[model samples]
Target: MKVMVQPVVRLLLSVPLCVLVACGSGQEPSPKQTLPLLPKDEVLLAADSSKRAMIVEQVLGFELAPVMESVAGKIAYDETVTARISAPVTGRIVSPLPALGSKVNGGDPLVELDSPELGKAKQGYANALADARLAQGAYERAKSLFEHGVLPHKELQEAENALTHARDDVSQGLMHLHNLGVEDEKIDNRYWVRSPIAGVITERHVNPGLEVRPDLAEPLFVVSDLSRLWVYMNVFEKDIGLIHVGTEVSVTVVAYPNEHFPAVVEYIDKLVDEQTRSIRVRCRILNAQGQLLPAMFASVDVRSGPENKAVVIPLTALFTEGEGDQVFVKLGDGHYKQREVKVRLRMKDRAVIAEGLEAGETIVTEGALLLRTEEANEQSEIDAP
Candidate 1:
């Protein structure tokens, strides 16, 4: 009995010791433990607080119709100083074509042509001159005969009439040769096409040995003074009243966007385009550096002048709420309130505030929609059950 009791006691003690050892080994923790909790994102002025920084505000200010009428324009050669040269008569182009971009003075020969039409003109002139000389000598002889009563009055009268007709023919022929660009000293079939204005040859469509005509659809050469250019912009009929001759404007081209070229309204078309319902306005640009090229698309800003001053804001700031125009006015830190405003004129990327806005007031220029969303959310939460 004692031996049995001793064995049971030893088993009981070893079991407790085993339990203690198991607990101590388990203290070395498993690999998949619970991670620490991260702090919550701070609540900004909006639901997505991170986007609150994107909301921008600007103080209202009065400007000369800050909403400039921006329109698409195209750069073109100033017609006042541009020339399109074509063949004066039917001809075949000779050697030595006009160099593209080469500067030329008025009356400078661009290309020489070998023309059969020119030859006929010169021949006709020569024939008329010979007939005139013969007619003059014949009239002198007939007059001498009549004065001596040797020739009949009718015959002398006929001779005088013949001389007059011959002289008239010579005059007409000489005029025709001059029109063909034939010099009196050098009458030939070689016609030299000359430039009528001083300019650089901007374009050339003629090549050696090519036949040219007077009524070619496209000119053979386009000579333009690149130092000055014109910008043609179309203004809507509603805006035409604000623009007129001498109105100052700003111009920008894709190649030089950072530079604002100053220009003035030179001419406004008398009639509005029936299709576009817009009047064409031409502005003169002085491109002394030759940076601007013809046919380049440009942006033109026609200021409203000092007479149309008003508070202006970016178009992004103006939002439609109900039937009225609204904008977000920043009152305090991270707080914006919507205000109904009256828009006098809306233009590209901007608007003129006629009422409900004042100078020096801070208004949201961007991200107004975000503020509106935040406001709607707050109101929704308030009405939640």
Candidate 2:
């Protein structure tokens, strides 16, 4: 998974040039009119742009928690078992092919290899063992005769040398037999290549009578263990700082929206993607029902809580300016300045500021975004978007 960022902006702006009437129109403005219409509570904001209602002042700090209090995520597996069991010796497949997804245990006959090379190796090993045994007997007799001065020392040495060569031949022949898949006890008969793991055969490329060569990529079978899986997701580089190894994670796939699986954060990429600017994260999930499959699209939510109080601005205050985020604050005495602020959390639509704001300051929470939009349009290139 990789992280990506796309900025979203919603703003409206207009200019309102207040006319000084010297309080002569004193019929009095409505309370709603005097207070200004916006979204938040305990807030008052003057529109620097058009008088159209856009911003709202409110008390922030709220969480959108479901009554169930559970996070939804998708399924994932980390360790995937894949192997192409090739013939170690040129051979003919003598066993029927295992069906795809067939379960196998260790030492189970996946298929038997009957090769001319195997028969030759077995015959050679038997002959070498016989020759070595006979040579050993002659060597022992000759050494005894030499010790009794009944035979020449050179003749005895020749017998011993013959025995040594025979022993070497025997050892090499046994190794060749082993390489041909002849277990020591089965060196006398042809045998099968059994499963190396307790898993299912995911692929079978060869069947009975299929002539396979040692030089060929000749795959006989493929196996995989699906008892557990891995789920991966991407986090924005800005959010990566909060994630750590062993963090609890939950995932839910689109195919199974009602079920959420649990997993532990196993790995978080150290580097951010150059194009997406997101960090990759991986979590290992154990399958209790063996339900997850490969390449399934999933949604993962990482729990990042322990909330803290932060300066929040009115949602109405932020106006989309080109591709940037901007907010207007009522600085003082009817003057409002558009400022840059990074939003962190949102409570009841009030955006908690991650940066660019101080505590207890009056910000144009309602209609501020519109005001900023109007300013940017009026100032055009003069103001940063």
Clash totals for all models, in order? 0, 29
Per-model TM against the reference = 0.70, 0.56
Task: List candidate 2 stretches off by more than 4 Å.
Answer: 1-83, 184-189, 232-241, 267-282, 305-385
For model 1, what is the alpha-carbon lDDT of residue 307? Answer: 80
What RMSD value applies to candidate 2?
20.1
The per-residue C-alpha lDDT of model 2 at residue 275 equals: 95
Give per-residue CA lDDT, model 1, range 1-385, as digits (tens).
4356888889989998999988888756569743222112111273447877888889987876743468999999899999888888999988698778899999999998999888888888888889999999999999999999999999999999999999999999988877766775355778889998999999999889999999999999999999999999999988888778999888898898789898999999999899999999999999999899999999998876778788988999988979999888877777667889998878877888899998889998999888777677666554568
Best-fitting candidate, scored by TM-score: 1
- In terms of lDDT, model 2 sits at 0.66
Worst 10 residues of 1 by lDDT: 35-44
**Minimal lDDT window, size 10, model 2:** 8-17
TM-score of 1: 0.70
lDDT of each: 0.85, 0.66
Q: Tell how far residue 324 is off in model 2, in angstroms.
A: 15
